[model samples]
Every structure is written in C-alpha cells, then in structure tokens.
Target: MKKLLLFVIVFSVLSAATVTFWAHQPIIGMEEKPIEFSIKAGSGVRSSVEQIASAGVPVNPTLLGFLARLSGKSGRLKAGNYELKPGTTPLALIDQLARGEFAQEALVIIEGWTFRQMRQAVASHPALKHDTAALSDQELLAKINPQYGKPEGLFFPDTYLFAKGASDLQVYKQAHSLLQKRLNEAWGRRDPSLPYKSSYEALIMASIVEKETGQKSERNMIAAVFINRLKRGMLLQTDPTVIYGMGDAFKGNIRKRDLETDTPYNTYTRAGLPPTPIALPGAESLEAALNPAKTDALYFVSRGNGTSVFSSNLNDHNRAVNKYQR
Candidate 1:
C-alpha cells in the first residue's frame, strides 16, 4: 500500500512538471505577432500551429489531443475572421475559436449612393478585396442582374456586417436583395391615386426624392410636389438628374450648361422621368413616393437648408426659389 501511494505522488509530480514546461514554452507562432496579426476567414489551426512551431516554440499536440478528448471536443472551431495578439498559445487560440470569439466589420451604406458608390465602398475596405471599381458600371450592373433595369435604386441604406475576407459582390448582392424586397413590398401597397404608372416609375421618383431631400419630415411633402408635376404633364426639371447625367466629370457642383444638357437623364430637357434611376433610394423615400401627401404642389425649390419649400404653381415656385436660392 505504501509503494502504491509513492508511485501516485511521483506520477502526479511528473504530470504537473510537464504541464508547466509546455505552458512556459511561449505559445506557438505568437512570437512575432506583437502588432496583432489577423487570421483571415477560412484559415485553419494547422497553419497557425505550424507557424508557431517554426518560430522555435514547442507545441504539445499530444496534450491537445488529450484535452480535446477529455472535453468531448469534435473539432469545434469558430468560423470567422480572427485577430490575435503576440505570445498567444495554441491552447488559448483554440479556446477562443471554441468559444466563437471572432471579429465583426461594420459596413455602412448611406442614402443617395449610386451603385458605383456602393461598389467603391466595399472595394476600398482594408480587410476585403474586389475589382469593383476596375469593372465598368455596365459590367457591375450585369453581375447583379436585377430583373428591373440597371442596379440603381437597388441598395438598402443601412449598416451591414461582414467577416474577414468577405467579398464585395456578396455585400452588394445582400443590399441589392434587401432593396428589391423592400421596394416590392412598398410598391404592392402603393396608393392608387399616386401618379406612378408602375413599380419602376415609383422607383424613379423615389430616387429623385432621395436626392431632393434629406429631411425625414419633408420626404412625403417633397414627393407630393413631384407627383403633382407628373400629373400635370410638366417636366420634372430635377437638377440632381442632370448632375447624374454628367457622370464622372460632374465636379462638386452643377453649372447652368449642365442643366440645359441634352441627356436622357436630364429631366430639364427630357420632359419626363429619367431613363433610369439616378441613385439608390431608401425605404423612407420609396414609401413617400408610393403614398405622397395629397397636395396641389406642382413645384418646389431647395430652402437652402436641408428642406424644400413646396408650391402649387410656377409663379409661387419661382418666387420661393428667388427667396431661398437667389
């Protein structure tokens, strides 16, 4: 019985000593990572473990196997983009994955963005990559392949979450899908008296509404002004559409010449809705377009602030424009 007790003590001491040695060996592959190196999504522990061992850090894979078995672990690894600090042990890293500790990237899509703007935002991200800007607008439009016209007015204005190595196309597709669903839902519930002939027309007006006003309270009222003009068969005369027609060369401001330009998108010349949406519209703009406030307003001008003053006739509109813009 005494010999048995002595054997147990020696075995326990050896086990503790072994654990201590491994614990102090400097966690594998963590030697050079003082600056927090990221483990991109889809990377596995094997590569990281190898990197650690090559950095002169000893790894006890047998011990890992033992602990894994004891914990009933069935290769439970967290699937996400991870960033780890220097001197992190393989055991510690595995524990993090097991607990599903991963990083989330915030992606914000603002209102009034063209599809190109949305594409550029995703392409320029540091953790993701895409040849979005390299592709022409036509080519990017083809990638999304909306049932409607081009991808304009087809991205939701909201924040999205992307993990490491997420594709730009993936995020764009998500926003596009959401936009389509929301627009379709709103179109189905449109007021029968709204001047829109179809969902497409509603989308066009919504895009104009998105560009025309940023004030939440003014959207429906501004929409009413445009709807009244449409019903009267007068030209939309939206300046933002003309700016969109100018495309890449449209510096920061619009000139008198740009307004008179004979482009399909120049509502000042075209006398009706633009050939396509000038920008992506959000849910508020879509709702406002579908169910505009009932008003006799046939014209509107920027209030020089973030809002627009609505008018019922050309004379009143010109007067408001002179008062505010001039």
Candidate 2:
C-alpha cells in the first residue's frame, strides 16, 4: 500500500510538470513580436493555460491561474482592443486583461463641422455606438448644455483620444471642456478694437469665417469683410448660412432659389448675427474673427477657383463676380 501511494504521488507530480511545460512552450515558427493584436467580433474568446497549450501557443495557464489567485483577481476580464506580446507570460496577459488594458482610438473634429455633422462622424465610428440620428438638435443641445451653454460653436475642434467602447456623451463632454478652456484663454487676449459686444458674438463671426474659407491664410480677410458689413449695417449675405438652414436635404450645390428661400439661418434675409452660430469654430477662426485685418472691404464673392474677390464697394464686387463667376 505504501509503494502504491508513492507511485500515485510520482504520477501526479509528473502530470503537473508536463502540463506546466506544455503550457509554456513557444509556438513553433512564430516570430518574436513586440505586441500582439486580435480582432474578434461578437464576444472575445475565453483563453486558459491548458487551452492555449493544447492549441499550441507558448502560454502557461496554470501559472496565470496561480498568480490570479494569489493576487485575489479571478474572473475579471475586460473586452476591447488589446496589445500583447509573445514574451509576455500567460500570467502577464491575464493580469493585463484583468486590469483592463484595452487599446485606444482617436477621432479628429474639423474646424467647421455642424452639430449634425459631428454627430454623424462620431456615429460612424465602429467602436462608438449611439443613435444620434434619432436625437433632435434640441435634445443634443440639452444633453451638451450642462458643459456648453449654447452647444453651437461651443465645442473645440481637435483630435481626441478615447478608449474602446467610449460613449458619445463622453466625447462631447471632453470636447466641450477643452473648448471652454481654450476659448476663454483666447477671448481674454482678443484685439481690443474688435466691434463685437461679447465673446459669444466673436465666436459667431468665427463660425461664419470657418464655413467661408478653408484656406488658413484667407481667414483674416474673410473675417474683415464680415466686420466691414457689420460696421456698415450691411447684410452679411453669406450663402453658407442658407445651406445650414436647409439641413441634410441641402443637395450638394447652392442654387439661386436656395439663397432667396427664407430661413432663420439665412444671413442675407436676417440682420446681424443669426440666432445661433452655424457651426463649431476652431481657435484660428476665433482669433481671426477677433483680430481681423484693418481693411475697408465690404463685400466678397467666391471667384470659383478656391479664392474670393474682396471689394470695398458693391460695384467692384459685382465686376469681380461677373469676371470670375460668369
């Protein structure tokens, strides 16, 4: 009976050793990698030391289980993109997942995106899930209002980093907070001679500038034309605002009828700044609006070659418009 018991003990020890060795063998022909990434849909796969060993990967499930038990961490796996390495032990991978080391992704918001456009861009991201289409502008404004007073032109445009499964609200809050900080700083340093009554008005002007020109160097000139219009109480007559009012139904081009169509956002029909900004403005646009060049320009018409002709009077503007537009 004693001999049989000794043999049983040896057999059990040998079995455990074999399992340990099998679990830790490097995968044959698998080159060393700095990080390993896996893309799995639905739900991630459940991995164990024995399972990995049986599948022929160099991983030690027993060691992972032992360490997890020792560290008082069991059944704590998080789902998301992950970066791991072959050099990483099974215990390390387990610990990494348990500690929630999920990969991150980034999204960049451009200078002149409207709230609707921003929502669409965010909704299209694979990692983020939200029904932005169902939410009305009012609902979106309300949701973002706690952080941004007017939602329009309130969020700063910039590249932001986010973990996988990040919420749309989270992204908005972050953008809003960053915008508040940057706008406040810029507003404090604005040119003293700017005609705006408040920083909000400056932001509204910036949004117009942002929509009017993509050329960074031309922002100040565009802003100057708007300021000139404001000083003379001339209508802004900007076409971008008309397009904005039409919303998504705005078929890709601007037409003469569309410009004449009455809408609250149509700067041609409405006097002074619109009730709200047309889109989110970036720092450069904001600065340009606040510090427009000293010029007598009162009118501008796009020359159709990615440039606009500026004029101090309507006749000059019309001549340039006829020359370039026609």
Query: What lDDT does each candidate get?
Result: 0.75, 0.75
- Writing each residue's lDDT as its tens digit, candidate 1 over 20-116 gives 5664454535447432234334645554444434444445545644444444442675555565556765556567657766655778999899877
Give the residue spans of candidate 1 off by over 4 A: 1-67, 78-80, 84-102, 131-134, 146-149
Candidate 2, TM-score vs. the true structure? 0.72
For model 2, how does the per-residue alpha-carbon lDDT over 36-83 read when each residue is reduced to its tens digit? 344343323334334434544454555655645545565565555565
RMSD of each: 4.9, 6.1
Evaluated with TM-score, which candidate comes out highest? 1
Query: Alpha-carbon error at 185 in model 1, in Å?
Result: 2.6
Listed in order, each prediction's TM-score against the native is 0.76, 0.72
